[model samples]
Target: MIDRRRVLKALSKYPVYSPPFHNSEAVLSRSEIAANYNYFLEQKARRLEFLASYLRHFFVELSLSPEALPALDNWLLRYGGHLIPNGGEVLFAMNDYEPAWVGEYHGVNIIHDISIFAGDYIVMKNDKVRWSVNYGDGTKRDYEEIGFGQPCLVGLSHFAYTGNYSIFHGIYEFCYAGLRRLRNGGRGSKWERDIPGELVRRLNYLADPDPPPQIPVSQLTIDD
Candidate 1:
């Protein structure tokens, strides 16, 4: 029983996101960026908790009825202009060109590219995906394709068509693994680097619920 009305109403508020070409304003200084980055990192626990709860919500609430296929399509239509996190642009970068991580899945490098959108993961704020894991093969096959790219839409869309519960479960597991890794302080990626400064600023802007008329570095801080 997906709350169709509530979800649609929430989706209506977000304008289609358009990435800027280049920002000409003076970039945040290293200290300012570090403050924002620290703030973002401090929220990792909350982010993981929200992800876990949302996964449960998607699984338990995204329609398990006779007319599941139609129900899924109705929601997918509302998600128009939103790209799932896969090879698509997530947060500040498009990860299609390279594999961010490589990991053994049942003995081989079955898992290929993994992308994480470091945002609040709120639809009203236009958050798309928390993270996505792509398998080695360049083909779509339920969970093997893109790991919970759009959880309910992607996973349930396949389940509705095939009527296979295992496919849906696999996708859930893939997404949960990302949350587990994040809790352990790594992005489940090959690189153990900090997020880029440009992305840090963008995230600060998005997370600001009441942004002032003009943005300032101090406003981005979450002091002790």
Candidate 2:
């Protein structure tokens, strides 16, 4: 479990700033760093325990196997489509024969980390994204809407280009506090009370999530 105090202590030493996602260079830089990422991925698995015990509703797992690549790939297309730093470096490409996700999930966090310090690393990071690059499919629920990671990724992008980490603080406060509330059985838990069973039911069916058909009692049959 990530000690709340640790996350809080890490966050306390920062101040907020207006996100620089509007600046073309910053957005492009964030994506570029995210795309060709290669570090600290193993750290993400540390979050799974807390997520499972405290926020079991959102916990979903994908068993890794060389043969199961197709399913993992398909799920990635939907989960990834827009957030993929590289259009071609699909999830499978990032993994090998290792039977675990290892550090794969850490890429975004690495991107998040780099986006906070005040500096421009993109020139060396991705010369191709020299000025700007358009992203997302022009819809209400694009990447950021999909998860808090996207916004944190952008917030760090804002911090990196502008030298401020408060954007990280505000967004994280909302997400973390919500998680804490659910953990402590506090207020604002109506949604959690309502959706966990449904989430587990659906996730359990990840291989093929088809709804069961309804039938009248008269049609029911017992097997001996």
**Model 1 misplaced stretches (Cα beyond 4 Å):** 1-24, 60-224
Per-model clash counts, in order, read 0, 5
lDDT tens per residue, model 1, 79-169: 2112223233232221121222121111001111111122222212333222222222333443233321221111212112222122223
lDDT of each: 0.28, 0.28
- Per-residue error (Å), model 2, residue 178: 4.1
User: What lDDT does model 2 reach?
Assistant: 0.28
Model 1 TM-score, all chains together: 0.24
lDDT of 2 at 218: 58
Q: Clash number for model 1?
A: 0
- Candidate with top TM-score is 2
Kindly list the per-residue Cα lDDT of model 2 for residues 1-224, writing each as its tens digit: 33333333333322222122222222234454343222223323433332223222213333222232334233222222122232232222122111121222222222233222101222223222222222444555433322222222221222122222222232222333344454565444444323223222222222122324545555675421
C-alpha TM-score for every candidate: 0.24, 0.25
Alpha-carbon RMSD to native, per candidate: 20.9, 17.7
